[model samples]
Target: MSTILTYHYVGDAPADAGSHKSLFVPKHEFESQLRAIKKMGLETVSPEEFHAGLLAKDLKRKVWLTFDDGRLDNYELAFPLLKEAGLKATFFIIADHSLGCEPGYITVPMMKEMLAAGMSIGSHTLTHPHLARIPAEQLAREVAASKQQLEDALGVAVTSFCYPYGNFNAAVQEEVRAAGYLLATATIRDNRNCDADRWQLRRAMVTPGKSRSRFRYMFSSLYHWLHEWKNRKRWKPREEA
Candidate 1:
């Protein structure tokens, strides 16, 4: 089965870190994780590659790397490391937070640079709001408008959509499909199998500073199946931003 890993921040922690500190993955640890991914012989593919391969059933132990929030550190830190390792990743950007609107989010120029460097870009929505609890009209606007905004800004078709905070439902999934996204990702609520659902792709989160054994376990069938069983009866779409 192919596995996709999701990440958030990729940089050193600030001296005066706040609640978001746990989201920050140190530069050294991030590099180590990449090396481990390589050592496992899992090729890092883009969303398009995964989609095509999924349809063709031609992938073997393939993996896709993804970053959420479009943090500037992804450009300043993860970009160089990924480039150096000859690997690629997809970044999910919040449309309204592009450029100067957000303090730490990646800017327009950085996104263009990432695209130029062969990385994939996707929509995380216009304002990163929770979709499961929003009004139908607002949900439609967030799913559709974010894709349009990113395509207009980057001049590329944004084919992937990740639910903000991994929040979504049947209606939200349909909206994402209606928005024209070929693939999407949700954290902790999905499996490694690509045949599950196109619009509600499952991804495992990769936190920094974990042992090699832990990382290996994350990609194992046991972990995936166990997580599935654990969440099956209690399954509910996330509702937080």
Candidate 2:
């Protein structure tokens, strides 16, 4: 099995972040977490490499680092730290928010720089909508059009995708596949095995305010089991009721 870690903003939360402040991890904390991952002797891989490893069944002790939303803070803060650590990650971009269309998101030039530095890019949809709730035609556009836009902008074969808000259904998965993505990531909190579904691959979220020890535990073998156990406990009462 391999571990995939998901992150959002890499700096302190801004005032406009509102209730989603937890998505913003402090810069120092993110740096420390990278160091911890290194200390644990885990090798980080790009999305393409991770997919290759999965196909070869050689994913033991491997980690795939992923960031979503393509926020500007990721380019300003996380990119340098990752470059310093000699680590490469995949950033999922919202096509509509990029290319200077939005103020706080990453632009085409920033994404090009990251790609030039060995980082990978993936499509996060056109506008980051809830795929499970949208109409089929809109879903196709979100999935397929985003891929074309990113590839046209970056000149790279965009093969990876991430579900917006981690919301996807069977239809969404099919749309992603039909759009030509090799793999898609979801917010499912668990480690993934080689046999895991490519369209719904699980990821462990790295959020803010976690202690050093707790952060380190995220890379341990026991984390997934504990996470799932707690989730089952949280939902068991509802199932019974």
- Point to the candidate with the largest lDDT: 2
Q: Candidates' TM-scores?
A: 0.92, 0.92
Local error of candidate 2 at residue 143 (angstroms): 0.4
Give Cα distance to truth, residue 225, candidate 1, Å: 2.1
True-structure lDDT of candidate 2: 0.87
Cα RMSDs, all models: 2.4, 2.9
Model 1 earns a TM-score of 0.92
The residue ranges of model 1 lying beyond 4 angstroms of the native Cα positions read 15-19, 99-101, 189-191, 236-241
lDDT of 1 by residue, 1-241 (tens): 6678888999877878787777788888889888988898888888899998788876677888899999889999999999988889999999999833588889988899988988999999998998998999999999999898888877999999999988888899899988889898887544366556677677778766778798778788887888788666555433222
The models' CA-based lDDT, in order, is: 0.84, 0.87
Can you give the lDDT of residue 140 in candidate 2?
Answer: 96
lDDT, candidate 2, 97-154, per-residue tens: 9954699898898999999999999999999999888899999999999999999999
Evaluated at residue 154, the lDDT of candidate 2 is 94
